[model samples]
Target chain A: MSTAPNRTGAVADGGPGRAPARAARPAPTPARRALRRARTWLPGLLLVSPSILLIGVFVYGMIGWNTNLALSDKHAPIQEGEFVGLANFIALWQEARWPAAVGNAVVFTVVFVGGALFLGWLLGLLLDKGIRGEPVFRTLFLAPMAVSFIATGVVWRWLMNPAPAERATGLNALFVRFNLDFLVNDWWTAPDFGMAAMALPAIWQLAGYIMALFLAGFRGVPEELREAARVDGCSEWGVYRHVVMPQLRPVLLSAVIILGHMSLKVFDLIIAIAGQQIIADVPAVYMWAMVFEVRDPAKGATIASYLLFAVALFVIPYLVWTVRKERSEGR
Target chain B: MSVQSASGRVTAPGGRAAGTTRRGQTVKFVVLLALAVLFLLPMYVLLVTGFKPFAEATAARAWSLPQTWSGEGWAAAWEALSSGLRNSLMVAVPSAVVSAVLGSMNGFVMARWRFPGADTVFTLFLFGMFIPYQAVMIPLQQMLVGAGLMGGLFPLILAHTVYGIPICTLIFRNYYASIPQTLIEAARVDGAGMLRTYASVVLPVSAPAFAVTLIWQFTSAWNDFLFAVFLTGPNSWPVTVQLNNVAGSMVVPYNQQMAAAVLASLPTLVVYLLLGRYFMRGLMAGALKG
Candidate 1:
């Protein structure tokens, strides 16, 4: 058995001279090395191929296709598309509703993002103070984060409904108690207050998520620094302003960016609360009207393309910031 | 761990000391309790409404308890919303599993292998993360129509899988990067192939990351409404769509809608609670610091 070819080769390979001599017999050519490298990378490429392929085809490719569609005059049952360059964009700009939608989106983004961040940070600060029943409070606050936007929207829509006879507890009753029947009627009818009503449910649903993010950030802040500030006779607010706030800036920005992105794409909550018949300030609702209600795919596509542009405006800055940060972090 | 003495009283440096901190603690506790109640009001209202009869639910003081307890709302909602829940599960579960598996594999390869276009490919996927869903919605719908897969679960699943990839990949890649390379080198030295290394060594240590990914993806897919509305018909609609329909319609029973909302939201809430600790850690572990 020892003298068999494999056994003998193994035994012989253990001897230094024989092993070196065998190893020195040949070195692969550059072409062969290249082929070996390709062999090693093949499995990895194969593993990632599906995700890459799907993203390439659907996300990037469709974006280009939509941009093209936005430029054309193609309506329902799109024919051989005529290159009616910029006509759709001009029409989109000229529409009374489009500007309203843009304004609504901007206002919604600012209010939702800013308000959520502020309230979230405050809650996080309270939680960080070694409050008792920490887990219970944390869970209670975070429950809304777990609730589906669908549920939030539905519940809020019910709350916001104008029927005085149907006005229940929660914000509706509170508004009524305060002589603010405007919540049920004038809030949705008055253009100025209508947007606020639409935004209320969204803010309620999202504030918890923002709080969670801030809680995470608060956890990351070292206790020693906080203690040092306190020892120096810093007021609670001063400690937060100086020691905590500086460290929390990045997390705050990230949360804002994420919330901002979501707000730009917001549709369901608005639709659920106001229904399609009432609120016309949101571009997404308008787009839905154009596509599903009116069955004008071309106009719908154009409207959707405008929304896409809005999303890009919010997302691109965050993406660039993220990438730059990642690179700087040497990842 | 040092207990520093303050004003002749010893207390943990950053800790909220007992007796000495009573006033501060009480104030904080009261504030927190008040906030918690306010925070939970909507859910309380939802639960109350769900348990009431339709008539009571629609009454002026709908938040008040019904004259009699009833299961009619639950039964009605369960009957009406069952199909929607089923549709949601079908789309969400498959999308989650596929996205997690594919994303983890992509992360593994990207972290371990140095390929020519790896950086560019990874960057491109990140680009998808930034592109708003609205931006791609129209084109994606058209493309699905072109492929004859629109108004079906398949398109929604495909769309979700694509949408989920960027975040999933980002998560797993960041996770795998933190894993020491020596493990991989050791596996290689032991004559373990790529699959053997991942299956035997890499994945075992990756349970926390996988758990987080699974929960996150599951909840996200389960809750998604935008794509569900566009990509599927009423027969294939998810709970979100049904919820929307019920909520949007004028004659919808408030009690039934509330019951349905609770039922629709329960599973994700349960999952979040069960994995709360791991989920928070996973969220923190991501590239959040920068």
Candidate 2:
């Protein structure tokens, strides 16, 4: 690590790029110089090798093994099973619970991401308005990002207590108090929409962080553009719509990618709120139930492999974009 | 007269805009304030309920203020979650520190050193960030069992540290990119090698990045539920798992559950509230970068 960083620093500082090659060059012993060059690379290699090994075994190696397990029918925990050739994947199509979980995942991801992005953008715009007590409001919005979903879930579960009408506590209790009886429902207890209800706290926990992301994005737009737009007789609304929103396209994409992957793989929030129930099941929760509760590793691995596919749908494109951006920048 | 201002009622755009904006500002303030209350209501409920007696908590309106402050709930929760809190701290601290150091090294090599396939190596590490924990848990646990490291805090720490590498590396890589290459070159000119320059120059200059990465790692590791549930059983459960268990206890007391929730959230909440600026910086510099 030491020698390699130094050599790069030396090359950057005095060699190759910024200046022309010197006319006078001294010839060194070829073999010795080659050995010296390799020696310089040792520390950097040594420094980075451990992380490479760890990530290799823990991340990629495990992922490869999961893909392998998905292709097999390994029911027993310790006992190895034979390859089944996409049987598990086919079996997933026939499972009622699998499809229900997939549907719930769709609702939850869309609502949660949409909710967070919308709320985040509103809050971000509000913050950009430079109102009084900005710091106080900003803190209130952003603080929940630090909270655990389990904690959020526990509180929301109580808050969303599905007690009917006047007997309600949590959110319903407020409706009863305010005579907004029509507004109250059996949140998370109503059939078919509990997972959607569960997305409330998920949104609550994340929206502020999303807001912070958008606020950062909003702040990145040049002030001069907004002023110039205003000077040209544009309203504040027009300035934001044209000058600001267009500039925030990348931020919007980033938010979607980040929030998209998060929602796809969300496990703790559902498990914490509903405890692997049939109604609110997402793949992560279902996968856990299959592996641990049912001891059906084959099905579990299949679900997991699908989850990986879902994550890759968002991440692979992102990784490609980022890597290409870095490569272009490097050149 | 020259500007025709006194000839008739005239409105300068800036003056009228400010007047309209002032009114709009109040509307925005009220809307935002109301939302803030809505946002803080549950947290407020969690806080005050922790101080309410179980009887009042069960009988009174959930939104009502505590009639009399009490510590019984906290006492009960502390009894339940103290060990989990300890275990979480045990898992989080070492994992965060180790990952931060490792990330700095990896990032340094990647950002500063121009080696063959370094970008590929980095992208490989970055891939670690995106893979779902659920996708890896079965093999991870099986491998842990095979290594005889299963059923302990070690697995939890190792999992967090290993998973932490990608984000931590990204943060450091981004951070180190901003550092003047001339600083490294200056050290090189002084006959300092990588370790020497990094030790004396880079390490000191990296305090901000370290704070960001450390805070990020600690918060994520603390809030982690899936790993704690899968990697470690009840004995080594982090506060999140234990808090869940506490909430799910057979004779569920609302006050006690609220207390446990508060306790479970306190570590990250305090860190966030106190070092909030750093927390935001970390989020921006890492995963939430838009």
Candidate 3:
């Protein structure tokens, strides 16, 4: 099964023809050795080549092409405009809404990622207590993950009605019914915290994902480890805080990276809930409006490039680290 | 693997088997119940509002049961979303199968077959997963337009399939990596070439992997909104796009909109509920093993 060549530079073949007689003979010529090597790797390369080609063209090639488009003064998708250097980026910086969009994105990332992590961890901890109907609760928590954000946004927009006092609806109306009138406010219409309000739905959709990750992490903690901790005079809380939580750091990191990147690219939900509103605008929604609605390819591409750059700031390092860890784990 | 010890000495008051006290368990359950109810509130609203007649579907009465339940909303939703659902199926099914097949091949090679710079290639593949689709959307749209493949389900299928490569590959690669090398070696020893070995030894036990990738790809492609908006036209609008349109229209009744939302979410939701265990496996595999 090993690919390493044994001593004497003889390639070990897996065929039935791999006999002692061949090993005893004089070494084959370099050309023959190369052919033997080709026979092993050729099929493997062929198997993976299609994916490599597709990813090369669609992912890497497109990124390069997008950067070029961003640099150019292209006003529309159809036109290949002249190279304008940083004019597009300059325009985006000068636009009043650009900084607002960035601010909204920051607010969104904080609320969405932080809220989902906290809620998901709490739910995961609750589920790990060996409760009955664990699957039922897990399913309920995860049901939103199954539903499309578009659908969730539709329901949430109704729930977050921005109507006046007498015309209240959705959650506001429900609050009125429960005499919790103080809790009712404009959800996604408030100028300052609109993006944070939008994060409510995002958190609802993703908290279950974090829960699932942490639950898996919990399962990986051996029963013996907990028992040993208990035997060492550790209470249940101590066992969880000292032993279990430490083991879940990787899961936490994964959840944060996953949720962070997702929040950075938040688009569909916002568009579904509020169509291109400045109050809730993130770069992603702004990019969509720029490209499709305004037909300004250069500016749109500039915004997109920044977004890609922002995501790559974290994702590329994480990917590289994970790969290195996997390799170092002897895979 | 068990280490048998002196039972009385090891028998602590609170052990893994003995479980927590009844009161603590009840508190946890009660907390979980409250959370579940909170989590399910939106769904309850969706269902209750959908069943309500148009007049009663307004926000003020959103929490109440339908005063006079009617099927008009469901009927209208079906009428609007049915075509989009078909279009989505057209996009999702092939996207899932094609990506899964390609990923299986790539995974088998990467996991079992050693090649120069394989890890680099694998890492490159992984990088594709995290990329903002916006970065590539412009080029992809122009490329499709230039190639006369724009404005239909084809571009969506292609986009999803191409984008799906990294994740599906990661899933299958991790899955196949855990398969003992001895099995592959045994197949090779029996005169099976690489393809033959994969066909005979690898593909049989690949059902779980296939289930994971196919379900993953299907759900994503089905739920996609950005690509559907940018890549396709009204003629090829998927359920998500159609749902957005329905929900966006001010003229559409709230009941109908709720029904449409439910209709749009049903397929992936149904798949998720029926195959939840496998779905969770896919989630864990993508997250932890990435």
Candidate 4:
């Protein structure tokens, strides 16, 4: 553990992209040098070997195993079925529930991500105004983040109760008390807007986190840059629009990637809010029902693989770009 | 334009401009206050409803204070959730400790030791964070069941520890990078080998990193429902799964369900309330640094 990081730091002083070549150069005494090098590398390698082994078997190996299951005819958890290539994927693609779940996922992602970003950005701006009692407000905003989605779901399920007219309760009841009859509609039960409505609690839970991210981004904007923008005949709005917002693009990208992948893999929140309802079904919920409830590992694995594919489409690239950017910056 | 103000907003020079700024600040405050209240509405409901009797906790009276407050719900919730809470603690504590230890070692190596292709190894570890847990669910179960470790909190603990390594490593790595290189160099000059240096030098100053990773892992493992449901049966269901079952049951009153939610959430809430700064640090490290 010690030698790996220590050696990296030693090489980093020279420059990025220079370590491999320098280390590859011919040594004066091959045997002694090799012995010393191995001594340096072995401890660090040994230190991280357990983690590498676990991640290797659990993450990468599982993906391969899941893919194998998706290709085979495994219906029961214990039973290993014969090889049946692409049948599960084809079957999943043909299922009406899969498409509905996908659609709901899209809607959920759209509202959850968009709402969280906007609300969090707004809160960030509000807190950035030099207000008093900042910590108190910040605490209030971020408290929801500490709560489990199951707990949040339990409370919100009541809050968004779908009963109508004389039987209304929760938010709907509150709306009626205020004579806002038009607003007293079914939440997360309305056919078209169910998933969108579910985003409310999600936004409530996560927006504070986004707010923290944006606030950091906002604070990290050097005062000199804002001063420079202002001196260039820019108004306050202009300072933000041209100077500050651009600097926050990376923060925004990070937030989007984080929230986006989460939205795709959403399971606990939806299940907690509404127990695997078809109207609000997401791929995760479908995958759960398929594997655990329905006992069809093949179909479940297929859905999971698709979800992985969808997530990897964005996450892998973002991760690569981030690493490459850091490397280019010579960090 | 006083430098003493916490935020970056500059006050205008003129009194009139200052008055406008003050007014704007008031408006901002009111808007923030209103939003804060709105955000906290569900929490208020949870508390109030949990204190109410079943009849008073109905949706129509959800906004009303209970005429006759009772601990019946709280008592019942405690009865239903006490075991699950214990289970959660059992799973979360070990998971947090093990992950923190492993992550510290991995992070120490990644950040300070320096190896060829270390960045590649780090990136591979990071990719594990984004993969849907579903992808690993089936195989992990098979492996555990085959090994006869499928039941109880063991599988859940094992899963949390393995899955947590990536984020914990990321947090610890970023943290260790910020430590001065001279310190490590000084330790090395004392003729301390890698393990000894880490144990005596790096580990001492790692409290903040440890705190962040521990709080993060604990909260995640505690809040986790997916793995808890899959890996553990009724006897070992964590607070989350138990809360779900309690809330989902038709016979359970709304008050008990709300009470159960509160009970289930209390530990993480307390942790956040106490160590929120470190939690936010962990949050920022995960999002921004990565």
lDDT of 3 at B119: 86
Clashing pairs in 1: none
Off by over 4 Å in 3: A1-25, B1-15, B288-290
Candidate 2 contains a number of clashing pairs equal to 4
| Clashing pairs for predicted structure model 2, backbone only | A1-A43, A1-A44, A2-B194, A2-B195
Q: What is the TM-score of chain A alone in each candidate?
A: 0.83, 0.89, 0.92, 0.90
Please give the CA lDDT of all the candidate structures. 0.72, 0.82, 0.86, 0.86
TM-score of each: 0.88, 0.92, 0.94, 0.93
**Whose lDDT is higher: candidate 1's or candidate 2's?**
2
| Tens-digit lDDT track of model 1 for B1-290 | 22222323323335534223455556767887887777777788788888898778755666677777778889988887899899888988888888888878888877664356776787778778766676677777777788788776898888888788887787788788777777766565454556766787788887767777777778888888888888899889988888788767768788888888998898888987888875565444343431
Candidate 1 regions exceeding 4 Å error are: A1-42, A164-170, A174-185, A231-233, A278-280, B1-21, B281-290
Candidate 4: where are CA atoms >4 Å away?
Answer: A1-27, B1-20, B288-290
Per-residue alpha-carbon lDDT of model 3 for A186-207, expressed as tens digits? 9999886777899999899999
Using alpha carbons, what is the TM-score of model 1?
0.88
DockQ of each: 0.46, 0.45, 0.54, 0.50
* Candidate 2 wrong stretches, greater than 4 Å: A1-25, A28-42, B1-20, B288-290
Write one digit per residue (lDDT tens) for candidate 3, span B110-199. Answer: 888756678899999988998999999988888898999887789999999999998899898989888898787666555566787788
Instruction: Please write out the lDDT profile of model 2 over residues A95-174, one tens digit for every residue.
Output: 68889889999999999899999998899877774666878998988888898988998888888888777567888888
Q: Enumerate the chain B TM-scores of all models.
A: 0.89, 0.90, 0.93, 0.92
